[model samples]
Target: MDLLPRKGITDDEIGGQVARIIELATLEEKIAMMSGHGFFEQIRESGGRLSAHPYRAGGGCERLTVPALYFTDGPRGVARGNSTCFPCTMARGAAFDVDLERRIGEVMGIEARAQGCNFSGAVCVNLLRHPAWGRAQETYGEDPWHLGEMGAALATGIQAHNVVATVKHFALNSIENARFKIDVRIDPRTLREVYLPHFKRILDAGCASVMSAYNKMNGEYCGQNRELLTDILRGEWGFDGFVHSDWVLGVYRAYAAAAGLDVENPEPIHFGAELLAAVKSGAIEPQVIDTACRRILTTLYRFASAEDPLDNYSIDLVASPAHRAIAHEAALKSAVMLKNHGALPFDKIEVRLVAVAGRLAIIANTGDNGSSRVWPPYVVTALDGLKDYLGDAKVVFAGDEGDSDAAAETAKAADAAVVVVGYTARDEGEFIPGDMSGDVRVEVPQKSIGGDRDNLGLSPDQIALIKTIAAANPRTVVIVIAGSPVLMNEWIDDVPAVMQTFYAGMEGGRALAKLLFGEVSPSGKLPFTVPASASDLPFFDRDAESIEYGPYHGYTLLEKSGIRPAFAFGYGQSYARFGYRALKARRSRAGIVVSVSVINLGEVAADEIVQIYVGFPGRMVDRPKKLLRGFKRVSLIPGETATLRFEVPLDSLRWYDASAKSWRLEPGTHTIYAGSSSRDDDLLRREITL
Candidate 1:
């Protein structure tokens, strides 16, 4: 019997089938569909790894021909063995190319299906409230508008292959150290305006699943928060898909079923026998269990019954050459050039001996070693890529800062030098030993993986290395590998050129080589603001049990406080020069349409990200100075000009009124700024009345 997906099935018919299956299933069988199975055996087989393959979490019944939900984790790629590792989500966020993000999502979906996964927890849209958050690499960026656009694109691409795309961490899951116990205190207005908008945007884009966070919001665990899961998600937003817990300790009690949680992931510690007993003892109603099962079956059947876009699910498609090319493209587009004093785009003929310094240059430093880690077939390092790119020109390498003198001498003898430095998994990532709340039986062995970063700047040794290399060779380029923004005030002035390559994936080295050799121009922009000092940002305590989330962060906070950042939110330099002119804005039927003409004045072809920001110069209520409304990526050759237009929705300009408990559009004249970055000097402004 063929079990492939069928073509052209209606939603009503799928719902009827789900209802029939729920009615036919026994009480025990129905209970079995609420959580993961084979918890202990999976751990044993993988030797305690987070996710070795696609684990069947819940939902399947042979008696009713119901299919199980096979789950895989990622925002980079399929979190399984030998998968194509693309740039991290934060790195891709820097690209600001929705089309590129969608293409990457399609590749991820194809790979997930080939690995036998029906559900993908790959669309992580959690807001980056603070860069110190360990898992910052998993999210898109700080701006709600930007996050929503990038995440929605990925979700749309993934669902095209008939896989259920999950938008994750429900709400306010930024802090990573005390994630399981922290009670995030956020007001309704701040919650709606800042954090929850992105999640709502992804759901509106037709995403099929959600993963509840481990943290608490207003003193209630997100896995069991009725206000968040039921009232808002179901009643207000009308989301019909299922929601599962994060991982082993995601759900603490069986009564979470009534609280709106549908499935417990990677195990059934709380939702298995305890839930059965709760139902039998009248502690939990049968209706709750039935509702959860119905939702699960409906989503599973809907995806399983749809026709897959691909003809075959070959294992060879896991890390195919085509997918790797996308990864390489993402790496190339995501690299942000922070500074350059005419010391970049090294000429291969002029530079014969190139010296590569630092320890990270030789290692395959893709990303954190946590759950999102992808085991690509191979990873190219900087040394290997530079050596390959410059065949005749000799490339020399130097190890860590322990031998700073020797490294500096090597740089002094070479024509140019490239020093790679930055944080590793030990410095920051997803905290592994999560709080084993309630009565979980599995013993989670301690792994040296992740925690919130205490210091935002690089180590003393790295700072010294940068200064030393710069002193020895006037032409030295510094490459930083990190998940989030690193404070570089200490040694930034000493280096002639610097680039932030945030955990570039398997093809990162090749992209880096291309960028350095002028094969491609650097076009990626900074997704988050880089502050001159940590105090310029919001107050953060990674280990705090309780914290208050405010209405401002990133560039908004900087502008509101009248402080200057070392680099603006959307700031990045390209080898090719770009000039903006002819700024125009007009009211359309949808809302407002803003257009600007951009011309490439340099000698090479390149891409430029056109940013549109909306500012309320005069307003009744307190608000950020300006918020990012829309962005578009355009490509142009030397001396060529392109006119780009962005449609700003009327709804995007509304502000949440705490007293009315609804969104309000303040009537006033608004200013629209268009430019290459968020800096004031880079933008051209126009005024419009609503």
Candidate 2:
């Protein structure tokens, strides 16, 4: 029998087949899809490659259907062998350009298909619940709207390949320590407003699958929670794709299948036996089993396999040099310029002293741990990039304590110092299982991840080294390397300049080589705010009183608490200056459209992201200080003027009014802002009197 059915198969045919399958299933067969087969250990390293065995050979098998489904992990980067390892999501998120994300996703999707694995089972858009959460670096950052926008772009990019792109863990799977069993207590208002948006966006983007969470929400297991699986996921968003359990999310086969899940992933326990068992026991209706089977089969068919109805999987364009160029470009744009005391644009460096600090100054400079910790043969570090670009300018190198006395000695000898500092692979990404195989090996998490980070600030050693270097050298530029936002309390005030280069991917070193020599202008923006101190907001760890236990922190609540961040979202600086003026906003029948004149006021060329935010003031429902409904990234040369337009569907301003349980739009004056950053005090707005 054909396992993969074409789309829109006759309703009668679908109904009939489901009925026949239901009638044929034994209780054991019905129970098969409930749970899966798993590897004996977390991971197995063989012949210089990693393989995840979801099933054991003796695992129960089912007779019906085609070959069993096999899948691998990833979103920020592909995990299948034979693909180029991209940078982590934290680094990608910093690019602040949605187009860049789409391009990067395309590259990832192409590479995954080329590597011979079906697409990533999940995009693991891990939301940032707490800064200290080990997996927080795997997320886009701490903002729901921003994560949603970027995640949506990527989801659409990858799933477009006919391979599934799974938007993961459903809700708050951020805290890794107590993830599996902890009851994540949260208020429904925040749940609908923030935590749910990214998942919703990914689903809306046509992702074919979703992974249930390992943790519980409001006194229930995530996989078993009907409210999330049925109510919000299916009820509210109208998601028609199949839902799979995260590794080990299922404890019972019949219960999970009856609970609205389609398949148990990784290891398909009992093979197809569980579904057959459910059928015989009468615990699950036959049609339900058939429907689940049909969904699974249909999904499997979408793959570029023998069963696939879509175009054959052949060469993947995403892995081509053209695509890596996209990643190279994004890795560059995601960079944020924190402090620029004219040590920027490095437009004039004819034979100046250049001293590089930290391991990231050259190759293998990226975060060393996690799924994205690529085993590529080559890498580009900032140090090597600088030396290569500076030509005859002798550049000094020193391993400054991550702040040691040795740092001071080196600083005293340079014409200028570019201190490269950031966490290494040890402190970030998916947890490494540790090599028990005799040879020294770094273990990485299989499926679920939780390794990295002991504190929120840089090591005292690095801070001390920074202070010494800053005091000794008048011109010190600290270049931060890492994937996520780090706390900058002790030494930020003393640095004359600072630049952040997230784990730059393949062409990373070469990109930095270009940026340093005035080859490319700096245009990356911050997706998340930098807190004045780690304590400026709620604890990065989910303390009993923090938002993780209830309502989470965002601009909306931050304002209520009267706490200000060191930097606001969408914030970035350019080599050239730009001016915003003459806001022309007109409320139309369709929605609200705003236009503004952005003029490049400096000598250098630059691209500016025109961000539009809508605020529902005095909102009865808890709302963000503003919601990013739309934005446009445009480029211009000096003295060039570009008029950018952004339109917000009236629905963008609507909220889930708890009282009515429907989307709400208050008939009040709506304020809109068109500016460079979320907290732009410089430009245009108009009140839409509805």
Candidate 3:
């Protein structure tokens, strides 16, 4: 019998079907449905490679006609081999284009489905509490509102293909090295206001599943934390989807199922037979198993029964030319130009020779070599792209960082010099042991694998290299490739032009070539603030056993401390100049509608991101100086003006009232600022009272 739901089947009908299937399932079958086959077994079968295809994790029972969830990891692209790798999540966040993010999500879902996967752990929305977090690239920005919108768009697009999208690392999962043992101490108000709004936003957007983090909140692991898994996620937010553990060590107790964890992924040492024993001995109720099975089966059947967007899923669709083009588009839009002194958009005809320096320029550095890594068929390096673009022009390249004098000599000879530098996978990524065993213990040394960054600034050698290259060549452009903010105070003033291209995917090199040669303009913005000093931000201890999380970080922290960032959040420049005027605000039925007229004053056509920041002036309660409430990306030609309006929802303006255990909207005069960046000088303000 086909378990796929027929067309037009209501959710209630699916629920009923799921209930019947659970009722028919035996105790053994129910327990079997709650865990994965085995991560090691799958790896062994796949010639010792992790996730050779999609990993099968529970719920396939022929007797019940319930389909199993084949899981694939992502946020960049499919984790499987030869899949298209788009720019990292941080890069996409810089673009601030929801439409582009949604398109990338659609490609991810299609590629995943074509590779025989139904569940995608691709929607990683963890807040970037600190740039030092090793896995910062997997998330969007530091703000909860921006994270929510971008994650929602991605989840929506993925689900459009009938593939289950899982928003992951549930709460307070920023740290990397000590994630397994770190206890994040956060007050109720701070938790609700700062870290969780983004997760709630995605849940409300109809995401089908959630992956609990490896870290602990308050005093308990997130997988088994009752307050997190049940009280907040399900009890308060009304999330109906199933929850899975992060990986092998994500769950510690067999009774995690009772705490609302539906599945233990990639081999459940704790939840498989151990959970069955707990149920039989009355340590845990059998009803918990039934509930988990019902949720998983319902979601699985619903997607399985839905009609696919394409007629057939072919392997050729994995990295199709069309999808690659979308990746290219993302790379183009995500490049953020931090500084330019009339040295950009290199004249292809006038410039006879170009110098490319640094090791990153020659290597295909996509992103962290962790779970989010996508093995595209080929990658275009900065060297390759320049050679391709400057067909007749001599493109001299050097990757030796130790020999800066030689590199500088090469730079001195060239008309323009491009120095590519930043952290690699060995420097930062998901912290995991290089070798694996059956017991989930680290058998081999892990000194060179993923871990949190110890320093926020570039290596001393990189700084010296930049200084040398800049001193030698008057026209120097430094392209920084990193997952998060890099302290550029060391050498930022010395360079004429700089751009942050955070792990731009396989097409990154080509996109870089286009932007450098005037084929496309840089339109991306800084998602996180670049503090002048590391001490100006929040206190971060990668090895801390216990840490307190406050409501402030990123631009909020910088604003609160009255510290000026080297580059403010939402700051970026374009070849075309944009003028903002006629700023206006009015009360709407929802909350408030803010409109601003923006015109491209420069001769070239370009895109501009109009940001809306809401400030609580003279408020009784403490709040950030301003919060990013709404934003829209607009494109304009020379002398063309467009009026853009953003609807600020009432819910967005509400502040969590810890006293009443509810959200309260303050009724008073609130200032609305419209600008390109978060800096006061970049914005024009208007006050509106509610």
Candidate 4:
């Protein structure tokens, strides 16, 4: 790399003005400026030495004679090393624990910097728009507010380790249907109110780049949409980071530049010397080119270290004791119990011949590919977890045809069967979208943002297996594994107990085992409702580009349509019986102060998730009948009383006054309901005024 110093500009000037780099770089070189280099080559070992090429994998693309920045995939876990393969973000969200997510991000950041990676694109804080979306496994669940807080926390933690976090797909990349062709038509209010808040939160948390998606938005490609990229992000929000395009989203370099995308990755896709030439020759404004380059250079300058430490060091990643502990804690907390018909907490000390079914019961994880992928050293499967706890009893492992016991062996010889069933890592949900085969070098895909799921039910094989297994074994417990809610219409009645452990992360296995034995009482609450079927919801497709949303798709709409969910949001079951009593609320100048006492009446210690839901009972505006105001997670011993208090601001209680076009407070009475879940309220009818 060679450059002639500007006559009057000092080195300090170069540092201050990244805009100057555009003046000196050639047209072709400028186009080359906005892409990235690959890090991981291959995941699984095949034959000879693990080879590294393009994308740090097999091989692709001839060199352009210009050096580029290097990047990799991750968030939930590191991709390189004999690393512990943790569950993706979707799994982390099911934990219903924000602090756990931050810790997960911290470790991931530590590993990313250690691996010599520059930027971790698609930090994946986007809200899940459609449950059937295949990429739903890669994103946080339905609520934008939750996603914003959790995603922002993770982004903030990752940046602390000196690696740049790139918040991804800018806007509405949720649906997988016709992603490349369909245009997502969304209302400005919904876009600003519901969808885009998480993005803003991520950027404010110090993310350095915002990756553009493959799809079109409002008729133009999101990658080069000026209104979205420039007007909203650069102009309105004042986002200062680079705008990188998804790989292979080609042929719109000038339009994209004018629109405001800074770096077109894996280059020549909408960016190259031709676009640069167009900029200088009056075809495209030089300011667009200058602004784009400056943004990228500004971001790149923050991480312009020439040294590569991970070039040599290889730690025993999966073997590290600390990593395992982290995984264990995450797994334990992530296990969310949806149904407990007094069927759990079985006589663990006396039970004999415990049989377990399903491959996931024996395997480490199911969703361990793509950006959220991780490399775990040792996995404690469901069978191993049960066996480890019940050393005196015979714990048999039966790999069911699906989630059920069609084989008849696990049940034929056992006293009780615990069926652990799930979708595979290679199944519908998520992937890095490249050749996982050792053949072609696979880098992150710029085009493959999402996909559609296969179907919503357990396969015919799994259904039949569960029915047969339940008939044989009277005391059977079913654990359902999924990234999003699916209908359990077939065997819901037969399975005495059921738990939804949605892709619990690396340590999930231990957590699952702990919950089963009442060692750790169930605490996690549902973030999204479990629909009876996909047809019941308004937007339940892979690609929901052109859907018109109102109160139907979201909680407000579902409540109006009288469509009952199989399980409501924030639904969970606990081993110990708990009671919420004496709920009181006082409204002051600041807002409302609510207090409640949570009593554990059962015989064992337990973790309780106390949720405060607020309802504007009368004279209010458009709101979700009630919304989650605050929640507390605590551990309680038998007969222990935990008193909890929370202060709510007036702004939090204010409603969006559409006619006035501003947030306004109305003189109205609101009801404060204290509950374990949205479906069931333990303490009711505490009033407050706003």
Any runs in candidate 4 off by more than 4 Å, and if so which?
1-28, 37-69, 250-253, 302-319, 391-393, 402-406, 409-412, 431-450, 541-545, 551-554, 582-595, 616-621, 645-671, 680-687
Task: Give the alpha carbon lDDT tens digit for every residue of 1-690 in model 2.
Answer: 443335555655555544555456554554454334443243543422443322321112255453345455664466554445456677777766777777666666666566555546537676675566667656787777678888888877776665567788777777665555567778666677667877887777777788887777887777767788888887888887678776543433445666667766545552255556656778667767656666654455544332333355455543556766676787667677777877665545542767777655654755545444444435656766676667535766856674456767787788777777777656665553434222223254334233646676777777777788888877777877766667887788998777777777666766775765567777777766676666665554432222245564645555556677777767777788889898877889988878888999988887887777777665455555566776778889999999887777786677666666677777877788888877747446767776
lDDT of 2: 0.65
Model 3 ranges off by over 4 Å: 1-8, 435-448
Please give each candidate's TM-score.
0.97, 0.88, 0.98, 0.85
Candidate 3 deviates by what RMSD?
1.6
lDDT values for all models: 0.89, 0.65, 0.89, 0.65
Ten-residue region with minimum lDDT total, candidate 2: 52-61
Residues 507-607 of candidate 1 have per-residue lDDT tens digits of 99889999998999999999999989999989899999999999999999999899999999899999899999999999887789999999999999999
Residue 103 in model 4: shift from native, Å?
0.8
lDDT score of model 3? 0.89
Per-model clash counts, in order, read 0, 41, 0, 21
**Looking at candidate 4, what is the lDDT of residue 545?**
51
**lDDT by residue for model 4 (298-399), tens:** 555554432332343335433357766776776676667777666787666556678888766877664735445555556666777777777635787765
